[model samples]
Target: MNTPSAGTRWIQLGLGLIVMMTISSPQYVWTLFVKPFQATTGSGLPAVQVTFTLLIVLQTFFSPAQGWLIERFSAKGMIALGAALSGAGWAAASQIDSLYGLYATYGVLCGLGTGIVYVGIIGLMVRWFPERRGFAAGVVAAGYGMGAIATTFPISDMIAASGYRHALLVFGAILGVVGFIAALGLRPPQLGETPEIPADKVASAARDVPPKTMLKTPLFWLMFAMMAMMSTGGLMVVAQFAAFSKEFGVADALVFGFAALPFALTFDRVTNGLTRPFFGWVSDNVGRENTMAFAFALEACAIALLLAFRENAYAFALLSGVVFFAWGEIFSLFPSTLTDTFGTKHATTNYGFLYMAQGVGSLLGGPFAAMIHDAAGSWVPVFCIAIGLDLVTAALAWFVLKPARRAYLGVPVPAVPALAEPLAAKPLAA
Candidate 1:
């Protein structure tokens, strides 16, 4: 196959972003649907909450499967399948009256569909910008966060005007159309299509270690822990932010959910997405450790503000922006760090394992935060917990990450063995 032009590569990225973006809107906007769905079915809070919780549970399960598919098929194929399922799930969900059917279709099926698509999109972006992993991944990942910001308000309005079932059907149709079109545009870069490097350059980059050897290193564990901690805080925000704002002071908390959309998208696309590339570029020079340390520190300051102030809109906005921005960078930073510290041969699998750590962190964070709020009857404790974790993340980034990057860069040739132990078996390549 002929190599794709730079423009074609970018177009593929954009299309992948759009597809991923659509898959996310339903999940993020769940609160809007919850009340109406309850009324429509004459079901109580338990039923509605179960639907939401089940969706998340399904998401966690499907992530690994999604990663597997990306290796076997191209990003486009996986995404197209995912998109079709998601659309069909939502459509079926709209027609269902029983909560069980809702859980099976919307909760299980749609969640799995989105999970598969997410892995493909992230993998694709990392491959496309191998040299600028942070920025490229941020741009694609940001589409998820940003889309919530962009769609939630208009979606809320539609829900109010047309009722929840109708809103879902309309949205499902839109996702189907947009997702199908976008999926058509995805194509992987052929080998040698990537930028060229001379033989001497490759030799000079070699190291003493072998592939799969790096798994035994302390550096890998530290990076994994650091990723887990950083992700915990961000996932906490995504899971609880709407409920937090709604519970605290906002009269129309749902409206504020839409309101927060702007900051979510802008901070992700602009601060996180844009800054990620810049940070990754800087990592090439100043070092990944230093660049990530700065990002983690930035996150600490944001979390601190939330702990210090309670329910203040401005404080909430600032904290939310920081959370989104840093959250965007976490995945972006990991791929390059893995490629640099390990090697590109197993980059995708390594990334998948690393992402599993993130998923674990998120899974832990949601319930942990809920416990804190339930016991304390306020979000202050939750914020305090996040701040503490952010501090740990900062320290890990500064100490462990810095030294690892230094060692990686100092080596003339990073042997595949040196990379082996540090990486888990990775997902398939984008």
Candidate 2:
């Protein structure tokens, strides 16, 4: 394949963004279905949320293998298949009334489908814009984060007007067809096709590191630990936001003249989407560890403020957006940071392993958190725990991850942000 011109690469990014947008509704808009599913299935909140947990767990747990599949098959074909499956999962979900049926369709099938599209697109983006991996990844990640902005309010209204089933059937087929068409346009960059222009701020691995070696390193695990901690708090909010909001008395309350739940969701999606690219671009200039520290700290504070003022409906709505804004950048930050640590050669599979941190988090933050909430008789303890995790992870990013990466690279700890030092990864052992 010939080197795609600069414009051609932008076209590639745009296409990936569209495919990303299509799969996003499943994860982001799920809160809307929780009560409805519960009413129909006669299950408790925690049990219904098990469906959400399964969706994330299955999506992430199988990612390493999914990455391998994409590497073996064509990225475009696999991605299209993933999109089709995701759409079908939603459509299938529309017909089901039982908890187990949700487990099969909404949880298992949608998880697998979205996972492939997510991991596949990130893999391609890292290679396509190696120099701007952080920014590129963030843009597409933003698509996933923000994709539901177009759907949340409408889906909420549809459920009110018609029903969840009607809403699911219409949107499922639409998102599936759109994602499939866009995925068809995507392809991996040929060797020497992508630019190698590296700024001092945006670092790259000196050489491509395979998944086995990447897994064995303390540095990778450190990143994983930090990501897992961060993911726990973020995933908790995403999966349980509606539940907690209703308990706080903001779900049906009006905020800015719209129902607080859907309004906050729409606003949260915007901030969530915007943060990915904004932080990704910032990381491209400042440094990944530096960026993580700032964002994570902001997240800790956002959570505390959210809970302290939960009784005021406007505060609940607005502060929830603050929480998401601080939380969502991990999608872009971690993948770019991984490609920078390991090489882009196995970016997909390497990220697949790291992405499992999210699965770990979904377990902790999803059903487990809900169980905790039920046992504790309030959401206060859950929010407090999430706050603590955010602060600890933020400290690790600057003090721990910074020094760890520098030591792994065998570079002296400069007074500067350590990982930002020039990196020349050692070649893989023969």
| lDDT leader | 2
Q: Could you tell me the TM-score of candidate 1?
A: 0.80
Computed on alpha carbons, the lDDT of every model, listed in order, comes to 0.66, 0.87
lDDT of 1 by residue, 1-430 (tens): 2344667667867887798788877677777777767776788987777776666655655565576666766667777888878777787888888778778878887877777777677767766655555566766766765566667777788878887778788888888778877887887777766553222221112332332565677777778788888778767766687678677664232325555444443444445545555565555444455567777777777767755653566566656666666666776677667655665544445566566666677677888888888999988778777777877787777655654555554532234332112221222222
lDDT of 2: 0.87
What lDDT score goes with residue 162 in model 2?
A: 93
Which parts of model 2 are misplaced by more than 4 Å?
A: 1-6, 34-48, 95-99, 156-166, 246-254, 374-376, 416-430
Off by over 4 Å in 1: 1-6, 197-220, 242-285, 342-346, 405-430
Instruction: Give the clash count for each candidate.
Output: 30, 1
Model 1 CA lDDT for position 219: 70
Candidate 1 local Cα displacement, residue 137, angstroms = 0.6
Error of 1 at 428 (Å): 21
lDDT of 2 by residue, 1-430 (tens): 2456767789999999999999999988898999999998999988998887787877899999999899888889999999998999999999998999999999988999999999999999988987777799999999998888888788889989999999998899999999999999999887777776443445566778889989999889999998999988887777789899999888999988999998887788789999998998888777788889989999999999999999888998899999999999999999999998788888898999999998888778876788889999999988988999999999998899866765665545766545444443333334
Question: Best candidate, TM-score-wise?
Answer: 2
Q: For model 2, which pairs clash?
A: 206-425
